[model samples]
Target: MKLLLASSLALATVLGGGASAQTPPTRDPAQIQAGTYAVDPGHTQVGWRVSHMGFSNYAGGFSDVSGTLDLQPKTPATSKLSIKIPVASVTTTSDKLTGELKGDQWLDAGKFPEMTFVSTKVTPEGKDKAKVAGNLTLHGVTKPVTLDVTLVGAGVNPLNKKVTVGFEATGTLKRSEFGVKTYVPLIGDDLHLTIAGAFERQD
Candidate 1:
């Protein structure tokens, strides 16, 4: 098998050489070119957690999340983020529990089929961080909320070879404030939300 061995060795050497020559470009979130980007729904997540009578924390997530982001890297205050979450896409551990959560006693998904957030302002906390203030409409009520946002990074996606940016945001809202007072104090009036979002350049 001398000929086969030589061919394999030569192929390995060529691949190794190519690998050594390619270096991932430096990632600088601040340098992300200004553009309109669509949030990659498949790579994005919307999760929420609530305390259950101080005994346990229940958590769930939503899918079919869609959004668009217009970024102004140079003037972050001008950037905007808008997202719509289908209440019917709620996911939990049990199918039965999911049904209960979507009923009139809770989210009332039948009445309000969707929840949305539109950023009204972006206040820079520091480099790569910001306080995003937005109006959240849910369960037939609207309230102002502020998300503590951190830029995870921005770079070219190796798989698709497209410019991509990611972020993690956390915020808290009072369920009662949104007219969702099913169990109130027992179910915990506050709901914590964590969003992991990815956006790709559109133009």
Candidate 2:
């Protein structure tokens, strides 16, 4: 339908960002300083992949996603995330396709304009990995989804001198679950999602 579980791994990445900031001494979530972090509006995105018949795969993504991360330093496993993804931001490299996505048979952005994901639990897998589970709401239906998350990096941005955290998350979802079953088994019932973004320290 549309993308952005952009809130997707926020559950995944929310597991963990300042200036005059020194380089990140350690990549460990616990080692890194903890505080509330803001998801970078411009640097974050939700990538979607679906099958285009048996011949090929069609891929696209959503942009302009925004979110917040509340990280618990000592217990990184308790971190929480909230993210918002607007249906209007979907892009598929084709104006016609993009239009179809926003129409009634697909996303129906006019009525339900936003898709959201809010983390309910974050379980640490190891030093840099975690399993984040959350409720995903799309097209007016809500479902539980889990993501596999890995911390990509954590450091101070040299240009801004602020602490930042980066993460990569992957998950699978069924577009039909949300009521956007425009194309059934032919197009694809499952959609693989990739969410990558950086969160900036607020405190």
Candidate 3:
């Protein structure tokens, strides 16, 4: 029993030492490096929320996202962003409801397989925040929208050893404006979007 306890203690010390050596990300914008970055689809996600009959807010998300970010830390206004999301990748708690959302009555994913956004203007709000105005194309309709974005972190990924940056953005839009006026008031016309974006620098 004493030998076993010594081995366990040695293992714990090694693990604790390794964890303590791991570097954390920096929040300062000055530490960010300017470069073109490709979306890390495995770490990126877009989530949405809508009201359900005035009782609860229904939540869902989309995976398999692809995007590019041309970052210009020196001239923040010159930064550009583009993102594409597969409509068929939408997910919800209920598989049945998820299927229904992709059907003709709702998003009509079969007819419109993807939604995209291209940033036209990037206005810096402060040191680590920005207002991104872009054209959003969804369900064969295009509309201008603006999202308030904040920098999450900038650091070298411990596993990949690549420099990465992350951001979170929030925006709201009316579904009816995008020609998705299905159940209008009852199902909620306003849709709120939250995006968690992760981009890795490319050579």
Candidate 4:
């Protein structure tokens, strides 16, 4: 009887251990579906750098922006993105320079209140890299632009428990093509845009 009881207990313990091992770990839905995400304005940033006077580059940023991203966790290749930036939100350390940038010769924020980008195609380059081809509208003109995007990964925020994903994209645009040719000879025509955005998963 003692031998049988010991054998039964051993079998029960093995079954319990196996059941515990087979149980699946809980995962966040955001990490699983990875569906659509919105840009976390508090954590995302959009910036651009352009030559000022044929000597040095000037950097500025847009403070007000909105965007949405559709991401597929299973197939990231089908992901899409759309963003809009208010031209009036352009800011620089120098007030004079900032005003000049918003004038007719430059961005003409009064006439064109916003600049937008809508993705046409997303081509995967590697494991965490993609080429985002899209139409960029600026200064009342639209042109095709390609952004080289690098996925910076995703994680859960410790404070809010929100799932967040990060990305970095860089592209160059010809200011003249957008009708922003103010100082062609003095300032370089190529404007380099660097975008770093963090998106928070929403219910």
Candidate 5:
């Protein structure tokens, strides 16, 4: 009897652990709580793509991104956001091209070590989307840009029990407007940006 009882307990523990480990985040907007959230840099990414000499679209990305979100789900228009990206963290498949992009002829990471965006207005589009207009500063120039943002998910993280929210935003910009006109027509003047943002609610 003791052996059978022990086996049953062990089996139950294993099944319970497996179930919890497979839990997934919910997409319900009502589950989001109002609070200030800090960006989870480890899971966030910013990607950019541009046409290369009419041959193909070359892509690159920036890592080590950090940001903050003051969320008010009930009054989403009042929400605020800010993001900072290190110009030096930009990466591409080609080491030589990456180095050239960071030099004075391109982004000039040495002179402008950081790029930033601060939200000036937020307009809720539907139940789970919004239009975020902000001032983007890059290469020592600041210009107004807008992003169409969609909620990816929101729920309590199973491992950390922190309230977390995710979003994916898309936008377009002209490099010439920011004063980084290097190889404009050849490298493509219009740039497409995609951002995957993750934020964990602060206590």
Candidate 6:
């Protein structure tokens, strides 16, 4: 019985030492790099809301957005973003409204094909929040805009083993300032924009 007990103790000691000998789990190196990344259109969307006739709000979205994001996961305050949304990609459920939005009175898609935003600075507000200051160009006019940005989170893509980051940002723009002044009181001058984007790290 004593020999058996000694044998069990020796086995336990060997197992415990083996467990301690193993290397500690480490995070992905690619995640640490956090370089320039491209927007995955399939996983990104740009949405906007504006008042209609001063009574209700009308919501719409724009497809065909392209962008580049410069990220430093460890230093999010230094990150940068630049995105372009084609005016012609605007869509509404109402066919009439959709046509009108693409006409001369509104976006005038034919004349101005794109709206762009370029970030100038990023200020950290909290652990997952930031204030992004940028220049937004729309309808041939450029104006400074501020967006409240929140980092949704980031991780490795299980299927591809690539690093991906998600973010949510919101901002407001005055239509009149961008030459989108069609109806002064009828349509609200304030346009609220929400952006959700997922960026995939590039090799």
Query: Residue 101 of candidate 6: its Cα lDDT?
Result: 96
Q: In model 1, which residue pairs have backbone atoms overlapping below 3 Å?
A: none
Model 3, span 10-106: residue lDDT tens = 9999998977898789878778899999999999999999999999999999999999999987788999999999999999999999999899988
TM-score: which candidate is best? 3
Q: Please, what is the whole-model Cα lDDT of each candidate in the order they appear?
A: 0.90, 0.85, 0.95, 0.84, 0.93, 0.86
Clashes in model 3: which pairs?
none
Superposed by TM-score, candidate 5 places the C-alpha of residue 64 at a distance from the truth, in angstroms, of 0.7
Q: Write one digit per residue (lDDT tens) for candidate 1, span 8-66.
A: 99999998887666545433546787899898999999999999899999999998888
Tens digits of per-residue lDDT for model 2 on 1-203?
13575676564554432222345435676667688899988789899999999678899999888899887757877899888899989999899999999999998999999989899999988888888899999999999999898888887777677788888889999999989898798899898999997889996
In model 5, what lDDT does residue 133 have?
Answer: 99
lDDT of 5 by residue, 1-203 (tens): 99999999999999899777865776666767889999999989999999999999999999899989999988999999999999999999999999999999999999999989999999999989999999999999999999999999988777778889999999999999999998879889999999999999999
Per-model TM against the reference: 0.89, 0.86, 0.94, 0.82, 0.91, 0.82
* True-vs-predicted CA distance for residue 190, candidate 5, Å: 0.7
Lowest lDDT sum, 10 consecutive residues, model 5, at 22-31
- Candidate 4: list runs displaced more than 4 Å: 1-33
Which candidate has the highest lDDT of all?
3
On a 0 to 1 TM-score scale, where does candidate 6 land against the true structure?
0.82
Give me the displacement of residue 79 in model 6, in angstroms: 1.3
